[model samples]
Target: MLYAGTRHRDYTLRVPLAGDLVDAQEAHPQGLVRLVALDLYRRQLLQLGEIPAEAITLELLRSELTEIDMAELERADAELGKRFAPPRPGSSTGAASSTPSSVTATPSPTSGA
Candidate 1:
């Protein structure tokens, strides 16, 4: 339920309150603020306006975390890492690629009889 906005004045990102988010809240109280930075890279929830992570209040987190959907939280956690994943080759858009192509392998030659 917690959200953020970019300085560009384009959109806002909604924080999906999943297990990790709750765990982070319990672990350090201010941990969710860090995750907010990650969410910015992912462009996860673009709606609110433009706000900085340091400005995101813990009180809001406490009030809103429970309201998040359980299923969405699971999805958000699973997809979190994808935010930093590299873009596909020949892709012009800066958006994250649905297809993962971070690595490629080459076959080695073998001796023939």
Candidate 2:
């Protein structure tokens, strides 16, 4: 569990345990730290002693965590989502849109019709 404030207030996190690291490694080979931390915290906690795991939500994590830490976490979460995310069929790996808006198909003049 990690204490958030300078004075180590009640708001805390119990994220990124051994299993979480193993799972992240299995899913994302490169293992970007902040990105994985965000994801794991969503699952593990926003603990204040005995806070239930179900209490974890993106909104709560953002609101509960220290402002300084959330800034970095948010940036990491938003940067290059595909880098940590599993690729789907026809999905672009890059951060930008790869799909062209207007593709045209023209039959070759050499075609014997």
Candidate 3:
């Protein structure tokens, strides 16, 4: 598990491991540290026949998280949701609408009618 923090941005990435810890000594010393860490973690997981890489994502990580880390993660997720949730249709405060408005249309007249 890895926790990454950014200014005004909350992003969580989680990868499940079922095997030995991966050695990161051979990873690149500079640039793309997060991707490298993920690759290393994934390699270790694969060696142990754990979950697939495709199963990992920010959303899944937020859900499966546990412990003190979970509290922090949830807070970050809530913040992110507030920041990125779609704007409501008619709410003045930008809050999401609970019920969507129904749409009704009258039938159009035909040319041969």
Best-fitting candidate, scored by lDDT: 2
Task: Output the better candidate (2/3) by TM-score.
Answer: 2
lDDT score at residue 7, model 2, on the 0-100 scale: 26
User: TM-scores, in order shown?
Assistant: 0.27, 0.31, 0.25
Arrange candidates by lDDT, descending: 2, 1, 3
What would the per-residue lDDT of candidate 2 be over residues 1-113, giving only the tens digit for each residue?
23233222233333235686566556656757755665565643344334455655555554556655455333433432433346898976667567653211112233110
True-structure RMSD, every candidate: 16.8, 19.8, 19.5
What is the per-residue lDDT of model 1 for residues 18-105, given as tens digits with 9 covering 90 to 100? 5545554455656456454333323343332344545444454343433223233334434544554566798786665588652211
Record all residue pairs in model 1 with backbone atoms less than 3 Å apart, i.e. clashing: 5-49, 5-50, 12-45, 12-46, 12-47, 13-45, 14-45
TM-score (C-alpha) between model 2 and the true structure: 0.31
In each prediction, how many residue pairs overlap at the backbone (N, C-alpha, C within less than 3 A)? Answer: 7, 0, 0
Name the regions of candidate 3 deviating beyond 4 angstroms: 1-66, 93-113
Candidate 1 wrongly placed segments (more than 4 Å)? 2-49, 69-71, 81-113
Clashing pairs in 2: none
- Could you tell which candidate, 1 or 2, scores higher by lDDT? 2
